[model samples]
Target: MEVNQNDHSYNPGDIVYVFYRNPHTQDVANVQSAAVVNNPENPGELAIFLYETYYPLTNDMAVYQSEAEAMEVYEQYFSFE
Candidate 1:
């Protein structure tokens, strides 16, 4: 499925959070902050460079608009509240 880039509120060079399912943990996800490295000409395809891992992630992942938004997601799902 092609994602409408316009619908997603993120721009290149913007710092965004990406979500990935933790392979070591069951039923848990990990969040990482990365910079929007590139948005391919093909609509909906985005690449991000992660600072923590020093690698570029191009797989299908959820990208948040801002750190605050990512925090909200983590709090709602990952937090033990």
Candidate 2:
């Protein structure tokens, strides 16, 4: 199945940065390099195939369109750190 590259926030295999928090420790992390795996369910949703954490990367995670956005989102939502 051919996927529309622009349909989602991130395309499969595209190198992108994600801002997230550790589910267990609640430690916030920002600008983490990750590759978009697939959007098996939703068009704009994405799955991160690789990351530093053991937690499964889900579509609900805060994915930024750009590195600048990552910084902003991190501070806005997860700046407790």
Candidate 3:
């Protein structure tokens, strides 16, 4: 299936960067490389595959096309110190 989420400017196989908060540590977060893919369970929707998990890809998500871009935003808003 060749699908493109034009609204989000991303499609299956697209590499994106996102902020991943450690599930065990509530305060620690890091930039992670993720892949955009068709959601197997949802069929028509897109999802972000990272760290062995699939997260729903929504318009509100802070997805970045490059690691540098992701890091910039991360430091600006998510960084504690």
Top-lDDT candidate index: 3
List candidate 2 stretches off by more than 4 Å. Answer: 1-9, 38-46, 52-59
What would the per-residue lDDT of candidate 1 be over residues 1-81, giving only the tens digit for each residue?
333342575546677786766767878777777777554544455456664443333334667776788878878888886
Clashing pairs in 2: none
TM-score of each: 0.53, 0.53, 0.85
Query: Candidate 2 residues 1-81, lDDT tens each?
Result: 223333444456676667655667676454776766655555455566554333234554655556886777667876666
What does the lDDT read for residue 51 in candidate 2?
A: 49
Evaluate all candidate structures by whole-model CA lDDT and list the values in order.
Answer: 0.62, 0.57, 0.85
Give per-residue CA lDDT, model 3, range 36-75, as digits (tens). 9999879988899998888988766888889998899999
Report RMSD (Å) for each prediction in the order shown.
5.4, 5.3, 2.3
Q: What's the lDDT for residue 8 in model 1?
A: 75
C-alpha lDDT of residue 21 in model 2: 51
Q: Give me the runs in candidate 1 sitting further than 4 Å from their true place.
A: 1-6, 20-31, 39-45, 52-59
